[model samples]
Target chain A: MRLSVFHPVSSLIYFAAVLIATMFCFSPAIQICSVVGALLELFMLESKREFFRNLRFTVVVWLAVAVTNPLFSHKGVTPLFFINGRAFTLEALLYGVMLGGSLSAVIMWFKVFSKVFDRERLLYIFGRKTPKLALIITMTRGFVPKLKAQYRRICDGRKCSGTYMSESRIERLKASCGIFTALCSSTLESAVQTGMSMKARGFGTGKRSFAHSFKFRFGDGVFLFVCILLFSAAMIYSGTGKLRADFYPRIAVSSEPLPMLCFAVLCAIPFILEVKESLKWKFCLAKI
Target chain B: MSKKTFSNLIFLLLIPLLCVAGLLFFRDKLYAWLSVGITVLCCAGYFLHFEGKEIKSAQLAIISAMTALSVFGRMCFAFLPGFKPCTALVIITGMYFGRESGFMTGAMTALISNFYFGQGAWTPFQMLVWGLTGYAAGMLAERLKKSRPTLLIFGAVSGPAFSLIMDLWSCIWADNGFVPPRCRKFFVRLYRNDAGILVSFKEFLCKITENWQVRRAQSR
Candidate 1:
């Protein structure tokens, strides 16, 4: 499914629920589920090349987190080895793996979120909540790219004028500083112009209305309901100790498997939706 | 004192006291939660305080512009390793504008730039550090504006302060508790790179200030 096609509110709810659930749920089973679900969702949503490219970074991060946690946190009973008089335990290693998995899952979910929530949708959501803050966000969003273009122009102009050429470190530094100052002044000047134009346009005088392209539909409602249900169920399961795991003194998992299965299904909802949508599209193409 | 100033004073005082209390009394997870909680409270307090004031479009425009410049500046210097003008720009913003604007700019820069850099738990901590740096500059604006040397010193000092705050977050995250000795290693590593950048930043500010002065003289 094109998650971005959903109403902003529905997408927001889904992401918020999944991301928070992944972060808060520390059990190995839940963490693994989250990681797998996130990876599948990313693969389905992103192009294969893009998915692999992102996967490399996530793997590096996962390895780093997994490695470092075991090194720093030397808790648990089963001593795997002794390094520099510090004991590396099996439980700590497992804990680190879980932490790494959960972290990567969270990161992947955010990547998907960024794809879905483009600048306009973000502005729409924030504008509804706080207009002034939304205006600032919008301005900054527009300003960064403009400033980058300006910086490049400044650099090119300076290079041509030989103002940037200097052998001495201090001279080079001062020249760059001159460029930076010029940039700042120009930026400030343009900001003043923007402010004046906004004032003329009756900005900050009254409540502002935003033109929204998307509206709440039945599909959005259903998506939002599913998200809420999954989130609440996960929370309830976690709260009742059905999803408990301890890795400090010793590694232990909860004997009850029903709640863990439910949690996995909850996490898999997004991936399932995407797969179902893709299959439907494929079938329609075949029929044609 | 007026009620608003009184509350502001109380908030200003309460923050440090709470920090000390959190450090001395709470450790590990509780301290982590407390730090996060305090940051949220301070951000909320600043927002509410700003809401009470009359914010002109000019102020908002300037803040947005400055924040964009700061983020871009950070990107420009990304290759230099620890030599970003974000803190300097934030300080400059605070020196010119009020504290709230500075804080907003700093906080927003952290939030927005992370869209490029990727966000995690560290984002909030970064926001707190940069926001407080801007807030500090705003608080000391009067003294800093008096002399170029003072501004330079503040710029240099803020670099270490920024690194120290970031190091504290890492220390908290890594050890799950603050150990002074463990934190020292991280500080030493950061200080080596950060100090050079900060000193250069001071010189950079000096150059900018000189240019501004010359412009003013010519205009007059």
Candidate 2:
């Protein structure tokens, strides 16, 4: 049960929970939960540095979006001023930033989830009857690695062929295009062969059996119960419109920060205990 | 650093000035292409010139100024609205500098400014539009600064025009349902009310004064 925390099911459940909570709750609920989900994914996913780096990138991108958005959107109750014959309102810009931050957070969360749920595991979970779709998802999962490998190959080739480091952006873009074309051609060929192999084995037609390693355990049940409680509380606050989120001409109070912080802490309890256990073991070993 | 470098900088400035003037004069395909082409060219030149070079303190300061201005502008628009862009500060700053400054300003403004505004749906296009605007401005500035008059004229014309550009960009996003169609439609509907129209007209008058103030501030 402790080991399964490192598995894909956790991420799946996390993703599903985020999606459901975001869909059902108010906008603030979506924002807060999504942020909490991203934070958890960042801290507990083992790839903490990568997650933090991506979070920083998301912040940078979110700022860019916030600046450009307000000029066009002059909506909402409070009017700040007017620019160039337009009534520029704080509401518009606030909404833009809120929307942008939520989006970036969601994207960051998904990326963290993907890191935990690699293609092999995704296929393992859904492979028996829907082999074709499973294979596609698995292949899609490797797209970034394949693309990077091909890009490196093209770069090496270009350097070997006397392409200087001082090439223009356009030239670099063109070089990448060449690499992409090569990769696409090869990937298509491989896909065809894979399709043929799958057809031969009757991959799509079968009574599906679950060979995946997600066992229903006591800890998982306990974790899920706590998750449900937290989510239900979030949903209650959100659905009642009691979870306020305002920022424009003043500030919007979304969920109470303390409660959200407490929820975040509760979610981390398992990982915290795991670390404490490990540290205890190490201390015992040193004593011996 | 040298007389030749100074002269080269002046020469580079002319190209963008011409592009901006051409865009204003032509108001069609050539105008759009002119700014875009000159910007791309200047960005290429900047890359070539500054390749592998560490940024000087002054350059870093300028970059920070640009980033701060962008963030300030975004926050103002989001929370205060009073300090919103009467002039396209991002565009002007970018044009005066280079692509690196422009891109950073554009990108950072969107992200940091959202601190006051919760994350919403319309962020991606906002990032792209501002980014392109800064990138274009920098390129134009690099290409057109041969004469002071041209620079001033381009600055004046672009300041007001940028507001229009943003409005149009919003229209594209709104009509296409890219994000916030409901919010947009609701606002427009509200504006269609008689009181809203009067308020909008009053806002228009206020905007002109705000624009002038921004211009004066920029000159300093």
**How large is the interface RMSD of each prediction?**
4.6, 23.8
Per-residue CA lDDT of candidate 2, range A190-224, in tens?
54465566557765366555555655667766666
| Each prediction's DockQ against the real complex | 0.35, 0.01
Regions more than 4 Å wrong, model 1: A163-178, B1-38, B41-45, B48-52, B174-176, B179-185, B216-220
TM-score of the second chain, each candidate in turn, equals: 0.81, 0.44
Q: Which stretches of candidate 2 lie over 4 Å from their true place?
A: A1-11, A22-24, A27-37, A44-52, A76-82, A85-97, A142-166, A169-179, A193-212, A246-288, B1-220
TM-score of 2: 0.47
Per-residue lDDT of candidate 1, residues B1-220 (tens digit): 3447746765787777766644443332345545555676666556555655678898999999999988887776665577778888888788878788888899888888888878765677788788888899899999987898899888888877888887887676544576565576677788688766776677667765676667768979
Q: Estimate each model's TM-score.
A: 0.86, 0.47
Error of 1 at B103 (Å): 0.9
In angstroms, give how far residue A178 of model 2 lies from its true place: 4.3
lDDT of 1 at B188: 77
